[model samples]
Structure formats: C-alpha cells, structure tokens
Target: MNGIRAFGATPSDLALDPFDEGTSSYSKAKDTSPIARLQERIDRGETKLSHDAQFGYLLSLMEELGVSTHSQLLVFSKTSLQRERITPKTPRALYFNDDVYLGFIPGAPFIEVSGMDSKLGGVFYSIDQGKTGRPRFVRTDQCLECHTSTKTLGVPGPLVRSFITDADGVVDMASGTSLVNHRTPLSERWGGWYVTGTHGAQTHRGNLSGREAFALHEKEPNHLGNQMDLRRFFDVSRYPAATSDIVALMTLEHQAHMQNFLTRLNQDSTSALRQFGHLNMKK
Candidate 1:
C-alpha cells in the first residue's frame, strides 16, 4: 500500500498558528475557566494538593472531581503534547468525567488537562507536578496546535487518533490512521490503548506490540474479555490504579468527539454575536 504523505503536507496544517492568541477564546478569558477556578479552590484551602510527587496531586484532583481510580485507561501512543514520556511499557494514564479529561505521563514534569467551560467548551491547562510552592495551574495555548485545526473543525476541542505504532509508541502514519469517536466501529478502535475488559469474543488493537508497523485485525466484540489485572504490562505500584477499564476508554471516545462539537458551537455563537453588534451599530 502507498504510504500516505505527512499530515503537515496540507495547506491548512502548514498555515496553522497555534499561538495565535488573537482569535482563541482561551486567550481572552482563560482565567475564568473551571481549571482556573480549581486553582482558586486550592488557594482557599478548599482543595489541598501535595507538592511532592505527581501522583499525589493527581490523586487529590481526582478526588475533588469525583473521578474514580477505577476509571483508569492507559494509552501507549505518542498522541499527546508530552510525547517524550509515552511508551508501550509506560503508557500515559487517562481519567475523565462528564466535563474534564486528566492526563498523566509516568515521568513527565506536569500533568496535561482539559475541562469543559460553559462558554469556551474545552479549556486547556497544565498543572505543575514538581512544584515546591503553591501548585500552579497554568493555562496553556500550545495545545491549540493540535486541538484547533481541521481535525477539530477549526476550534479548540478533543480528538482521538487511532493508528499503528512502533515499539516506542510512535505512530506509523504510512500504515493508516483513523479519527475515532463513539460512532467508529469497535474493530477500528483502540489501536494503542491497553483495553482490559471482556467483550464476549470480540478483539481490538489493544495490548500488542511489534518490531515494525502492522495493521490491526478485525476484532469481534465477543472475543474481547474484561481484564482487571495490568501488572503484566508494567509495575502497577507506580500508578494510582491497576485496571485500564475498557468501559472508560469507550466513554472517553464518546465525550471527546462531543467536546469537539461543543467547542465549534461556542466559537460560532461568539462570532455571530460580534457580527450582529457590528451590523446594529451601522443602523
């Protein structure tokens, strides 16, 4: 099969301005997002976080948000901004709720996060995992490079990328790629995640590694089984949870795509309101 060219070959990708704060809603009111409010809670001692290890802070945040450790899902793909820390053996752990997504890489300096805003749809943030002073929740704009693009319909949003990966978790774009969502077929899902649930006899592209790029097989949902033990993959002690529950992965896929749609809607309404004001002033 012909290897598809790089994603950056497209004109829109070449023209992408990730730091163009001029148009992003985040640049305008980042300080008002839910993440920002969470920081305020920290300041008031309403939410306490340990300034020690990343896990401590992660655990605290999860507790505050009602996210269970049981909801853990591991992704070995280098599909995030902190690609350097991802690998097949040490996958990034993801936890989510109806309104937020929390990402933690084993040895990364910070935890990548996003929370839904009533106005902005999805707001990006990074909490310093190594902070000695007050833990800083910095609003990040770099995420827009991937979150705001044709893939997301040109707004800040969540997206899931499915592709064949090498041993180190680097995607082999030449093989193939799929923009996954809840609607995506189960067989075409979870290319680089460790799914730990039984789905009858169904099979998926999870929990496998090879020396070279290889296409995923057609996995019947019945072949997949619910797995609660993940000690075989890595030391379960290092993480807060052991199971990479398949149910959580399925929920993540659904919410991620929904978040993208919400973001675009927010941006559209904001733009339209501005246009209406300009036309009214002319009358």
Candidate 2:
C-alpha cells in the first residue's frame, strides 16, 4: 500500500512530486512598480520558488466552487479489441503564495491585480452531467473570518485538499493522516461522504475514496501533520461557478501572499546583515 501523505502547510511539503522544471514564462509583463522590489530578489536568486501546493490549493478551491474541470479532453481507445470509451480528468485547485511569474518578466510587480469583468469572473458547471449554467453569489464573510487567520493562530485555513485512498479501503489525505474508514463495504469507497463514487479511484485491491480521504483529515484536526480545515471557507452548496463569491476568495488569497512575502523579506534582510557584519569582524 503506497500510503498518501497529507498536504503540507508550507509549499516544500507537497505529497505529489513537483511539476516539470522547464516551462516557459506564463506571465508577459515587466515589473517597474513598488512590487518590483521583491522581483529583484527573485532575479538575483535571493528567494526560493513558491511550491505547487499553492497552485493546487487554488485549483481545488476552484473545483469546489465549480470553476474548473478535471479533464478538458476525453481519451478514447480505438483498438479493434476494445470498444470506444471516454475518460476525463480535471485539474486540482491552485493557489499562489507569491507573484511567481514576475521573475521572468522584466518589470512585473510582485503582486499584480487585474480587474476581471464581473460577467466573466464566476462560472460553474454541473459535475453530475456536464450541465452549463451560473450560480448566485452570496458573500460568505462568515466563512473568511476563520480562514484568514494568521499562521501563529495555529489554524491558517488551507487553499486545497486533494483526496486519496489507503490499503484498508480507507480514504487517506496527501497532506495529513485523516481517514474516512466507514465499514459499509460497498459505501466505504465513497468520496466526501457523498457516496457518489466520482472522487474514488479503483486500484488492484479496491476503490480508493478521494472525498472520504479528505474528510478523514478534517475529522482529525490535531493529527500530527494536519494543518487546517479548508471546508470552512468553501461554500460547496452553491453550484455552477459562484463567480462573485470565488472572486472574493481569490482576493483574500492575494492579500495573504503579500503578507507572507513581506514577512519573509524582513527575516532574510536581518539574517543577511548579521552574516555580513560577522564576516567583516573576522577579517
């Protein structure tokens, strides 16, 4: 049984391996604004790259709100021995702790905020049947109250949580050690307690429940590696893309990244100065 590790609070702590190393620049702008100060550090190799965990978190949040899909293209086998079939997979939610693309762009700021037209902002579709439509946006201020807490608070809400399964027919998390190990036999493999089987994967042994696995982590809050319960800020009940609501969620995320970057910069500067003065005295 290849046990799954839970998602880490920090980017360096993801379960899935890192993405391919050499992709072209995704952003196309220069950084001449105040945010450029951070960009210079990145260019000079003074800062580390942000982790995929951030992007994954954003993708998951989008999916929960019905913003993105698993598979954009359907795969079909055309061999004579096999009948035609289509398989689809969607991407996980994505989050960002910094303005990563600014490094490659000559003058882009560390934080870029483009105003997306309201009409194109929130969009959703029915996972049940690929039905297309829009959902109403109700501001979830109550949800953000806890999610936006600082790290020292011990409950900095997560941006995403991808689910997986374990050997005992239990749903395990990649970020933590929570398990939704129900004993119904048939229903044991259901995802997120929905029993929809949409989020389960069938392995050599049995079906691995993705949603159940995620729920397990949520259930075990204090589990050694468990960080925060992401379900708190997500209003899954609203279907089809909760555009306005999701926009607000992303906005908060943007602020969070700015805060994180400033904190790190301060620490790095202090350490650098301390080391530099020490070297001078030694000489």
Query: What's the lDDT for all of these models?
Result: 0.70, 0.24
Clash counts for the predictions, in order? 14, 34
Summarize candidate 1's per-residue lDDT along 1-283 as a digit string, tens digits: 1112222233234233332453353677654556777788888988677644547478878877777887788889888888888998889998888887789887788888887876665678898777556777788878877877766645566777777677788887764445777777776777777878777656567765554324233333333235557777677777888878878888888887777666555555555566565776888
Q: What would the per-residue lDDT of candidate 2 be over residues 92-125, giving only the tens digit for each residue?
A: 1122222211000111111111111111111111
Weakest ten-residue segment in model 1 by summed lDDT? 1-10
Tell me the deviation in Å of residue 158 in model 2. Answer: 8.7
Candidate with top TM-score is: 1
